[model samples]
Target: MRPRLSLPKPHRRGFLTAAAGLLGVSALGGCERFAASPTGRRALKAGEDANMFVQRLLLTPASLAKEFPDSQISPWFKPNGTIDPPDRAYKALAARSFEGFKLRVDGLVERPQDLSLADLRALPARTQTTRHDCVEGWSAIGKWTGVPLAEVLQRAGLKPNARYIVFHCADTMEYAAADENEEAETDKTANPDMEARPEGAENQASDSQAAGSEAPGAEAEEAQGTPIRYYESIDLTDAYHPQTILAYDLNGKALPVSNGAPLRLRVERQLGYKQTKYVMRVEVTEALKGIGEGGGGYWEDRGYEWYAGI
Candidate 1:
């Protein structure tokens, strides 16, 4: 667990600026070497842990991010990252309006849970209008409503050894159509025989195309490797924050597919990247060593900071 939250000092604003440059170069750069080179690594490197430590030490557990008046909300909250996931299992769930979508919770807990959408909605909910600061230098204020994550953690009963909370998402980093062999190999669990397709289907939630991207139905070729689904983590301190929600609604409406339907993490204090979309599961673990090259997030694996404070 991390310390309580508090305000960052003026000197640390430089860290934020440096992080921006780090992110830009990271976008165009190599693998983990961003932190391992002889020269100072642009990514978090040694400073990553220090950043997390300072944030937790300074920030208060009860401190809240700025909330905007509803009038200030954006006309549209632009969606980034994988807009559509073409995974067959996710398609089926979305087709039925995610009636079958289950947010699986396991790892380092007492009672493991498989919570349905309704199950989650039935819990206590909070709605807040807050700014989403994206790493790409964009910001938007929108009202988000969902259950407080701490409530769920209490329900699950965290074990003594539990430390970091891992979020498994449905969004894939590499957007490529699955080849027949790959599809067939996963068919039994992911694409098993079922009723005819629904009117519309998609999690890696939207195959909705990005600029210069191919259509969903474009032939899936023999790519070098499989797509990597997005995942991220945070210490327990952030998880227990009153404003930390697993949001199902944006601006008083159910989140659209592009905005991480049926659920997404809303750690109000962190940058938008930490608010991973298309969340599928949550895992509690002591250390990050065994997960995704041990960097803590998809981008972190590439050299971005695990603690991307605003």
Candidate 2:
């Protein structure tokens, strides 16, 4: 068995809370000031890269994150990000208790697989109670049970060229749709014979359009005025870590919708955002380019550090 690490007590946890708050403020202010300038952004990115390098240098690749006992599990584990995805297709799956839900594992694999929750549950599983440290200065301990990511990766058979793992999720973020509208206008200009559709496409139901179309690695295509879906990525090293899992149960029960019900990532060593919720597709790729802004994660593209090590 792998050696287990232990976390500090409540007093030291308080110290971490204060330190996280200061770091959060500093990071936010720096981004607000420097993100717009090309040189400034590069400098910020350099700092992030350096942080990643130093952490990797100091810690062994397989070093486990600290774990706790059942008694130490927080009474209430707080949820962040999208608790309920606004996508209609996701709602349909959830309504039936995710019977039709299949987690798609594709991209740079010898054998791409579409795995049901039952398929995952049948695999050898790991259970651990660990503290989730959020960048927003809160922490909660919860027991998570799921298959180790390495097991799934091994089953998929990674291509030798694969360098990173990208996680596509169900939740989305709202942003101005001006760019989408502009692209539509440009397409119309090029194809003068194209028939024009009304604004908002008749507010059509997404599930109706996607009925019987549960292809492996398929995500809901963005519609005009629709939100951009959430995505995140990690390196192959972390992906294969013994402690990293695709958690389906939380605190001795099936994970609730409010807590990433169908499946969520438990990358114990990183901050909360890196533990992406509502995970749908796992894409293995050689590079981050063509992924969200080519920054490896939704928040990473928005100037947050991609490594986000705790």
Candidate 3:
């Protein structure tokens, strides 16, 4: 078990109170208006940046979240966010027990690879019992087993400029028109190394469509009606942390669909929202511009802090 990295309970309470007071100053309508203004946006960005900087100082790259023994595992780990993705591709894979599923690793890398559940399992693996702290003020402890993210990143060979890692997942969430346009722009960035889709991409995509799933780029057709696929990003530091893993199992059994089946990110140091689920692709990038509203994550775009360090 790693040492616990946290503030004292009183300090945490004081911080929360100060934060709420700041937020309370702006009434509902005024808050929206202010957040939309240029100055307000800049101020918000500064606050977020400051918070990230301070948190990173405490949550160093090699610092691990406190882990517990098997005896401390929670009886019930409550599921949050999208438990079961409604996408046809996800449903099809789930139906067959993810036999044909493949996790694509691409973008700004020397070698792009597609790995299956078996492939991931065959790699060096880590299992730890860690507590999941949610943004909603809930926590659950569970044992997870998977390959360390660093192992996969090394296998893919990150490019010299690679600065961030993005997790593209199967789950989808709807956004307003403005948000949709922002997402459209994000898909425009080119990955030179991935210009030619990997072989596994074609195979998996075709299989998905054949099984009633929508083809890639179907989101455009849906327009106002379609839901954007979920995604999240983290820096190399977190990516290589010993405890950060691409979890495939929970407790002692296979991860359930309700808890991000086949694969999910277990970034133990951060809050639950950063723990993306149903992950399908790993994209290494040089910058986050035009990616998910330029905020680096699904929830981050909607005002959540990018670094949700405890």
Candidate 4:
């Protein structure tokens, strides 16, 4: 187990300053050198360890980052990751304005939930404007509103073993279709006018038809089927943070489809990807290794760190 260290609230600034100084020195030296040298790695790790210790010590359960007034809202908040869902179900929901969509909350809770958009909207809500810092090095500010995640967890009666909360999404990485045996055999007998469609042309055709149809874009759209929206998991410490919420509204209005309509997770202290959009499920588990690549999140499995505390 990691040791929990505490420092006075007033000293946090100084602690960070000192840690930054150490980091500067460590970075200037080779990271390998720091790792190879027992003393160096210990010192470098000390900065992170100390920060975590201080946060655990000085920050009370009620402590929260400042919430700014609406007048301070950012002018533009770019959508990241999958902007538009390609699944027929998602498109159908989108066509119906998401009225038929429902969010499911299950796993390690006393009561499983199948909540409608209206049900989530009916819950007590919180709204705030916060900056989203992506690992890619861009930032955006947006207003978000949703029920507190703790409230939801409490309502569900979180199991004692639960240590992390996972968000499941409706998007996925696209894959290429494997070559068909029929196509391979037909290559020998195909007429000059009946050449096989190029992958690009096939994709373009699929994009033009509606999902579940023979129309040009239909197959493409349907094939894109509603991917399980991107999923991510965070430790229970952050899950229970006061700022963590299931956001239902953005900018004082119902969330647009482009911004994950109905509901989303807002874990303020982590990187932007940790704030999963188009959330369909929330699962509480003691360990993340059971999910995805056991790294905690989709991006985490793809090289991002799981603990992205700001």
Per-candidate count of clashing residue pairs (backbone under 3 Å): 16, 0, 0, 18
Give a tens-digit lDDT track for model 2, residues 1-310.
Answer: 2213232223444444445544554667556565567756655565565556556767887899999989999877776566455566777787688998999999999889999999999999999999999887889899999999988988998887888889998875543365644532221111112232333322334322322232222243343344467799998878888899999999988886657769999999899889988899999898999987888897788778898987
Which candidate do you rate higher for TM-score, 1 or 4?
1
Give residue 306's error in model 2 in angstroms. Answer: 0.7
Please report the candidate that would top lDDT against the real structure: 3
Model 2 vs. true fold: TM: 0.76
User: When superposed on Cα atoms, how far off is each prediction in RMSD?
Assistant: 8.5, 11.0, 9.9, 10.3
Which pairs clash inside model 2?
none
The candidate scoring highest on TM-score is 2
Candidate with better TM-score, 1 vs 2: 2
- The lDDT values for all models are 0.73, 0.74, 0.75, 0.65
Tell me how far the alpha carbon of residue 147 in candidate 2 is from the true structure, in angstroms, after superposition: 0.6
Tens digits of per-residue lDDT, candidate 3, 232-269, equal: 99988788889999999999888876678889999998
Q: Mark the regions of model 1 whose C-alpha exceeds 4 Å error after superposition.
A: 1-39, 175-225
Task: Pick the winner on lDDT between candidates 1 and 2.
Answer: 2
TM-score of 3: 0.75
Model 3, CA-based lDDT = 0.75
Note the residue pairs that clash in candidate 3: none
The ten-residue window of minimal lDDT in model 3 covers 188-197
